[model samples]
Target: MLETINRFLQKWMLLIAPSAVILGVTIFSWLSSYSYLVKWVFAFISFVSCLGLNIRSIRKAVMRPFPIIVCLVLLQLIMPSLAYGIANVFFANDPYIIMGFVLAYIIPTGVVSLMWVSTYNGNRALTLTIVLINTLLSPLLVPYLLHFFIGTQVSMDTYGLMIGLFWMIVAPSILGVLVTRFLKEKINKTASFLSPFSKFALIFVILVNGAVVAPYFRSFDGTVILIAVLVFIIACIGFIMGFFTARIFKWEKGVVLSIMYNTGMRNNGAGAALAVAFFPPSAAFPIVTAILFQQFLASIFGRLANYYFHVMRRRIDRRQNGLTGI
Candidate 1:
């Protein structure tokens, strides 16, 4: 029964996300009271998602440090900068919302990205390494990046943000890794059991966070629509940038797939959590809006990656056959 429910949730996740947002909006008053629980839910999500990570994969991935470095730069520095610029150009009058845009991109790459990477036959080691390293560093990087980019515009509790990220992301991640190390094969069943619970928890988090941003939807006018459009465009750019950057570095298709997913998918759950916990409600709006589009975009990009690599393989095969006079 648990497995059946898990399979159903995983199969229909793309539809579920947006539906949760709508449901939250409809019942905003009831759900908004539970907003404080967002942090706990996110911590649980972080813990369960990290259960599948192999510590040994980190060592293997680090041996090829250049690709990892490239991904980190794209994930942390380049994307946030792009988001900041785009947000400012369009919404200069709305600093909180602009802060929302920056926050959405600067958070670490999503652990859920591992699912996408695995689905596309990506480099699991590389994806795991990137997720672990980026997540561990988020407590530090997120605070500093927020201060550096939008500090003057909005007052933030930097210390609180750090501690929150530590407990919610870093601490839970470490515990999950330890379980994987010690429990070994035993933990696989445990992780599998918890996987569906984690998804349900994520849905709950989205619903509650969506309630926090319900006011925005009530006044869903031109500005709101524009923000949604901009968010979608920026997300598309992340995937495109990751793909070309890998191609430019002459990385293999597997690495390209890993980097593309990592670069493209933000830990929006974490983003929404921080937005609600520390920043104004306006900030959470963009993050919640991102939840609606993220999984759908990932599905589309996965197909695009498949088609892109298939064509490349066909061309290579043709060249080889021509050379052999076949």
Candidate 2:
């Protein structure tokens, strides 16, 4: 049952995760609560998750970042603006609901999604680079995008968000990478243990976000679902647009898949964090929906990359040369 349950959650967004987050947020808001537990838990998970990277990988990525950099630029700037334009067409008059749409629109790439890219053999370095660059630049690009598009009502603290993102996301990743590198001989024996903790923490963060956001659903005026639809549409557009862009560049399958994953997956965790700090409670609904869209399509992309890109194509090429293959 445990294994089966785990599979289901893996397949269904760590099952009940978004639900739990919605529930937690609702309770927190109702009781006037801001749990350090929730924040630290997410921050810790985000930290430990990135603990396996090294400066070597970072530098290598930096040297050869054209494809990834272009994708990151599109994801951080153009796509968010596109989401906003579509959203404005629907959410023009209502400021609070537009808040939800606008908040979800401007946030950049996610780190966790890069894990999915790696697990399924979809250009790990490229995906990791996108996450790193977008995050590091979020201090500037995120605020600029938000200001240019939405203009106000957002608590624009570029420094705070950057510092918070670094502490919560980038710094932890650097530390994690260092630990894995310097202590490889010692930690290698027990590194497998980190997976369970990381998975649990990720689900916990999702649940907390859900719980915190649930309060707004009670009085939601239908705009929440509309914004959710908007997020879905934008995510799908990202997937398709990325594929075409990769085709234009004549990238290999790995590069193409990398772009697809980067474009499609927004950082819902970061989005939620921003929502809580910068906007009203109801402003987080689109971000909440984004968690679902990101997790689901990312999983599907991972599976496809694993089976088709890694396994099947290898088999096809091997047969052409009369050799056995993966």
Candidate 3:
């Protein structure tokens, strides 16, 4: 029964995400009261997401660390810098909103990226390793990156934010990895059983965080529309950047797919939690809005990547055949 439910959720995830946002906004008042649950729920999701990971995969993935290093540079430096520039140019007057844009992009890559990578036959070990590294380091990287980009304009609890990430992301991730290491094969069955529940927990987090940014939608105007548009465009650029980077480096198809999803997806739940806990509602706005589109975009891009690789394979085969004939 749980497997059936998990399959259903996976199949309809694109619709489920936007529906959760709409439902959360529609009943913001009731959900807003339970804002305290975000951290705990996020921690649970993080834990569940990490259940498939183990130290061995991570160690193996790091043996050739160039791909991981490239992904880190894209996630931490290049993308956030682009976001900061775009936000300043468009929302120059509102520092909070500009910070929102930066926060939306700077968070660690989502564990959900693994789901997409698995579905597309990407390198699971590489994706898991990147997720583990980024998530573990985020406690430090996120706080410092925020301060570096928008410190002069915004006053944030940098220490508090770091601690929050550790509890909500780093600590739980380590526990999950340990659990996987100990349980071995049994954990796969357990993880499958709990997959549906974890996804439900994710939905709950989105619902509550959506409520925190409910007020923004109530007075939705051109500015809100503009922010959403820019956020979507920037998110698209992330996938493109990763795809081209892997291609330029002449990586395999699996590595290219892994990098694309990792680059494109952010752990918006963590981002929203930090935004609400540390900054104003404006800072959470871009993140909450991102939740509405992340899965949908993932679905679209997954298909595109598949088609691209298929065509490339065909062209390569034809060229090889021609060379043999000559």
Q: Best by TM-score, which number?
A: 1
lDDT of 1 by residue, 272-317 (tens): 9999999889999988999999999999998999999999999999
Going through the candidates in the order shown, the clash numbers are 0, 17, 0
lDDT of the structure predicted as candidate 1:
0.92
Ranking by lDDT, best first? 1, 3, 2
Model 3 lDDT, residue 213, Cα: 84
Clashing pairs in 1: none
Each candidate: RMSD: 1.0, 4.5, 1.1
* Alpha-carbon deviation at 285 in model 1, angstroms: 0.8
lDDT, candidate 3, equals 0.90
Candidate 1 minimal-lDDT segment of 10 residues: 23-32
Lowest lDDT sum, 10 consecutive residues, model 2, at 27-36
Residue 241's lDDT in candidate 1: 94
Candidate 1 global TM-score: 0.98
Clashes of 2: 17
